[model samples]
Target: MHGHGNVPGMDAASEVGVDVRWSETLRTYHAVSNELEHELQAGHGLGLSDFELLKALCRCCAPDKGTVLMKDLEAEMYLSQSAFSRTVTRLEKAGFVERAACGFDRRSNFLAITDAGSERYLSAAETHRAVLDKHFG
Candidate 1:
């Protein structure tokens, strides 16, 4: 009990609703993340972060400008810059994305998804959506 009220089965820490809610949120996130990682890898040969990076780029792809700069995508990604860069490198090696120097900026680089990436993303998206629907629908 939190010393505020008695919760039948919980100790002081877990007795409070706020504490329970926070823990449940963390639990749900982990469950979803683990499943996503597993299914993406098993079915698509892609990691969860890899799928997410591809998803972000695909969503933000402009009709005129299919490329998006790292800075522009920084907000969409949950990883640190170094981690994101590493993901990009892995995707590039897998032939899913291309990293190119910006035409007008020396220090800026942009990412463009390949045709293969688009096709892969199309297949993986169904898996991603199915998982989300099962968990949160």
Candidate 2:
């Protein structure tokens, strides 16, 4: 009786494909995330989140001359503003980022990545690329 007792309720079979795809996607994302985190930690003593922020900064058009605004990062990364703010604060404390008032917008603060931060990011990125190539390619 136990073997057949747990049939999923109405339309369950039809929806199973959607559930499977979502689960698979999550699994793949987790695997990639774990690899990235491990590589960053070993290569730069930085967390995956820190590496992401640095990458965003390095990708900025005016990295050396100005800060990347919080709103821009939030939009680009799809992070909540408060989450971005907390991560920025962590980077700032680690000497990987600096905050300054925007020249054009007093209400906006720009986050700039430091030289050390850039170097660390490059190293971790190299490691991450290697891992992906080895596993996925």
Candidate 3:
């Protein structure tokens, strides 16, 4: 009765344990993400989210093709709709990404990584992996 409303089998101690673990997980996520963001921005002028977007596009496309549908990219990103759109616009302006109409659906757009974008992503990916290796490996 002193803790969060009880589930059938769960107790206050269990609730506290869950909360502590969740808090730690969040803290770790933030720390790792921030470090990666700083490394990417300092080394490549790309933010973590920007690098992630480029990586997603590259993963979705073949070596000869570097395009992903806007919807698909949205599904891959953790950002809100408005934030994703803004990120895309920012990358486009930076010449790292390009948006084009989907041939099958004029209402839909496809995002493609440019040569510059691919190079940036590839370089930043090394830093990203190194950071992860340092922390999690």
Candidate 4:
């Protein structure tokens, strides 16, 4: 449809749709994030980003071995210092995440996912998996 030479059902836009791939990827990620967040909100009563942060922290084996440093969370979550701080604050408010001074590095702080946080993560993860199956499968 873009030009005269374009064949039926083979318009230039149809043939070359890669321009929107980046946007599509971002949109998909956002949709998935929102879906998981909605499930958590309904079932576990936790915010989206806070649930995600707790899940990430729990993945660091904090539950078994204890705590993970704040810097480690920032690096793993790829969040800016201010944004990450805000997330941690929200988590702390929700009783899912907590921060403490790193014993080894006094200047650095540590993050821990609490029991409630772990349970919430597991429940949200199951819901997330079901949503993925419903949408992607």
Candidate 5:
């Protein structure tokens, strides 16, 4: 039965195919994520989440100021608030980013990429692209 006999509207063969595809997808994701994590950590001292947050901030930051609202960035991130906050805290500790209170909204905070962060991001980005290209390109 392969555990698919109970699945309604799906034939055994289709169920097996789906399972194989799902397994492959999981394997690929883990492989790529592991590689990225390794390279990023060795090359930039950053994890995947750290690199991603920096990249996103660099992309969405105000052109002149390199700043964005925490709420807005949080909305874009797929992580839970606590996870996002932890990442932010790590970056802030590393001097990669800064946190500021929003003047207009007391409840809102702004994140700004520091000069050091930009440099790290630029360097890490090259490593990131190379790893992905090596795997997929």
Candidate 6:
């Protein structure tokens, strides 16, 4: 009888509070993502996903082996398979990333960051970090 609609363990006031919190969190996330997307696109002609892929590739690069396997790259991505593939294709077309057939596994492809990609990532990283620092720091 104390709860909303006479439901047990559920109250109108508590439900409203939870909904408000969830909405606020989502709104904040979207706002931050939008700001980053705008800044990156304006400064480097790269979208947030593009920048993330390039940065991941750079981190995965080794001195002797500069490429990361497609499977490995997929693990680091937040996008769906189709979306990730599309972004990769776009970056490849832009000459920022190159894909090579894996010598060991015919079914696997390796993705490597080109010199241009590295340069672009490094430039955009500064701006990305600055924005994060401003908002979260």
Q: Which stretches of candidate 4 lie over 4 Å from their true place?
A: 1-15
Candidate 5 has which clashing residue pairs, if any?
none
Q: Mind giving the per-residue lDDT tens digits that candidate 3 earns over 3-95?
A: 657465667778789989999999989989999989999999988888888888888876777787888889988889898999999999999
**lDDT tens readout by residue for model 5, 5-123:** 66566577787798899999999899999999999999889999999999999999989989999979988877899999999999999999999999999998999999999999999
Ranked by TM-score from best down, the candidates are 5, 3, 1, 6, 2, 4
Least accurate 10 contiguous residues by lDDT in model 1: 1-10
For 1-137, candidate 1 gives per-residue lDDT tens digits of 23766555565655567778989999999999999888889999999999999999998879677799988876799999999989999999999999889989989999999999989988999999999898999
Q: What's the TM-score of every candidate structure? A: 0.87, 0.78, 0.88, 0.75, 0.89, 0.84
Q: How well does model 4 score by local distance difference test?
A: 0.77
Clashes of 1: 0
Model 4: per-residue Cα lDDT over 30-116, one tens digit each: 987788778878977776666667767877755567588888878777578898899899888888777887777789987877787
Per residue, candidate 2 scores C-alpha lDDT tens digits across 1-137 of 22343566655655667789999989988998898788778777888777777777778638347467877876777467788888889888888788888889899987777787777777788887887787689
> Could you tell which candidate, 3 or 5, scores higher by TM-score?
5
Q: Against the true structure, whose lDDT is highest?
A: 5
> How much is the lDDT of residue 98 in candidate 5?
99
User: Which 10 residues in a row give candidate 2 its minimum summed lDDT?
Assistant: 1-10
Runs of candidate 2 with Cα error greater than 4 angstroms are 1-14, 63-66
Give one digit per residue, the lDDT tens place, for model 6 in 1-137.
44447664647778879889999999988988999999999999999999999888888778677798977887898989888899999999999999999998999899988888888889999999988887789
Score residue 107 of candidate 3 by CA lDDT. Answer: 86
Q: Which pairs clash (backbone N, Cα, C closer than 3 Å) in model 6?
A: none
Q: What TM value does model 1 have?
A: 0.87
Measured with C-alpha atoms, the lDDT of residue 90 in candidate 1 is 95
lDDT of 5 at 116: 99
Cα RMSD of all models vs. native, in order, equals 3.9, 4.2, 2.2, 4.3, 2.1, 2.8
